[model samples]
Target: MATTRKQHSEQSAPGPVAAFARFVGCGGGVGVASSFAVAGLASWIPWALANALVTAVSTLLATELHARFTFGAGRHATWRQHVQSAGSAAAAYAVTCLAMVVLQQLVATPGAVLEQVVYLSASALTGIARFAVLRLVVFARSRTQATAPAPAVRPVRAAAPAGPAELCPAA
Candidate 1:
């Protein structure tokens, strides 16, 4: 049986709502893991290195979740695709962290509590940015496939007779 254009398009496209939900669920899991890691290991490692390590690991987990759930099982994304998507997210995360750092510096707080507050705010921003990028880019269908017009079908016409038919005389 032949597939209709609508069926093909629907099969190829991922739903935005489902993708967003998967992103949030995966991000929450990653966040919990990262927080645990940071809380347990921050004293042992430099802050920057610890953050980088946690982000890298969390990104891997998030990418796998995105591929499996957001993009669906049959659609396997290349490493480069994963990197490009995750890199955009990471860049956003870095910017958020930098902004928090700058803010903390300007505020000039004396206690460790201020530093913790900045970290939490930055973490939340990073997760939000990561989810947005994943939904908009990583799991989004290719533009060529998504927007391409379906092939047109023409109506079939009966073939003309090779010779003229004899006309019947009126009674």
Candidate 2:
């Protein structure tokens, strides 16, 4: 009964498209803010390491946002969700890093503007993918339970007697 009620609540939360919009809004805000931090840190350290640090912090923040606002989980993310989301974030980190590496290979001296453009572009691409994975994988359990039908309740039929109810009549 409790599970059914919980599932019913989750069923009323945002569907995929709405959740995607929320995901982009919340997660993108965090990503953009972290990018600035990453840029600053990169000036002081290696770009890859800076991005990695920012990615970890931003992943935790975004996971909480995704749990509370994006998917309407209405609570803080569990450690499991955080870890799963971190996996997605790691992939996103690899994307942005690879994009930067490619840009460096292509341009002998990319300006700050070019770097930001490439970085944000790669982030946007990966954001879409991250949304899908988060929606269908990380945050999918509630939605799945919500949408799934309740188990059928069939009446228990009484077994018929083997031929002669006359010989074995009920007392």
Candidate 3:
């Protein structure tokens, strides 16, 4: 199918606040879903392993959404973007893990709701940081290049029939 210019620029480089909002929407949505996935996976495997698996998958999914919607890349994330996003995700994973460990130490028998609160709070904070990195580093070039103004093109003028010499000789 053909894409119209309107469709192409539909996500045309949102401002910082708008982009962050979209970033949270995309990341938060994936985060919530991944939390559930982790919980399910933990039943069969170690919690750390489950979280790692979920993080990897969710990072890719979130990166794609952020590229197309949040950052106005208007396309799929590049391999480099995905790798960089994964790095951010790794940091986020560490933060969430650290938060859970802290929660565990504080409460001998923390409830599921309490654990979720800590986890999601940590996720949310790291998500903000991730948005900055993705915007400034991972997808900066794509945004600038896409929205960059096209270069001007001057019309080529034909030779003026050798100017005065041609005019006099021909005359």
Candidate 4:
């Protein structure tokens, strides 16, 4: 006897919203790694340029992971889709960075603690915004036949005789 594996359709796979959320989380991880790399390289290069380099590299890695795993295997996202998602993520990053700057200016905190707080806040905010925008726009699907539910199946039964075969047909 041979065993056969069931082929799962993309529609029947996990929810898009959930997959996107996971993708954002993975992106955050990549960003953290990039930050560490930048920190090490900042010693050799200009600080501002090092930060920018890390940001670009991390963003690319995150986007690739999102396209591959979050969207589903073998589904290649278009350039427009990438631009839309990246725009949303960039907006979120900008907002968070601005907020951190304002907070730092207002509080006059120590540099080390302030830096940690700022990055943490920005990562959280960016992750959330990425999830929302991706779910709403990037992966939004049409309500077409692709998503339609399968038709319900009902068992068939024979109809009974009208008068019991006319009382058994005289045997």
TM-score, one value per model: 0.63, 0.81, 0.84, 0.62
Best by TM-score: 3
- Per-residue lDDT of model 2, residues 26-81, tens digit only: 99899889889999999999999999999999999999999877886766788888
Cα misplacement distance, residue 90 of candidate 2 (Å):
0.8
Cα distance off (Å), candidate 2, residue 138? 0.5
The collision pairs in model 2 are none
Model 4: lDDT to the true structure:
0.63
**What C-alpha lDDT, on a 0 to 100 scale, does residue 123 get in candidate 2?**
99
Q: Model 4, 171: alpha-carbon shift in Å?
A: 41
Candidate 2 Cα outliers beyond 4 Å, as residue runs: 1-11, 146-171
- Once fitted onto the true fold, the runs of candidate 3 whose alpha carbons sit more than 4 angstroms away are 1-7, 153-171
For model 3, residues 24-140, the per-residue Cα lDDT tens digits are 898999999998898889889988899999999999999999888898877888899999989999999999999988998999998888878888899989988898899999989
lDDT of 2 at 77: 82
RMSD of each: 8.0, 6.0, 6.8, 8.2
lDDT of 1 by residue, 1-171 (tens): 998755554355456676567666767767767766765576898666677787787777777666665545334555865786669657855864686569767887635556556666677776677667765666555423454567899999998765534455446
lDDT of each candidate versus the true structure? 0.64, 0.88, 0.88, 0.63
lDDT of the structure predicted as candidate 3: 0.88
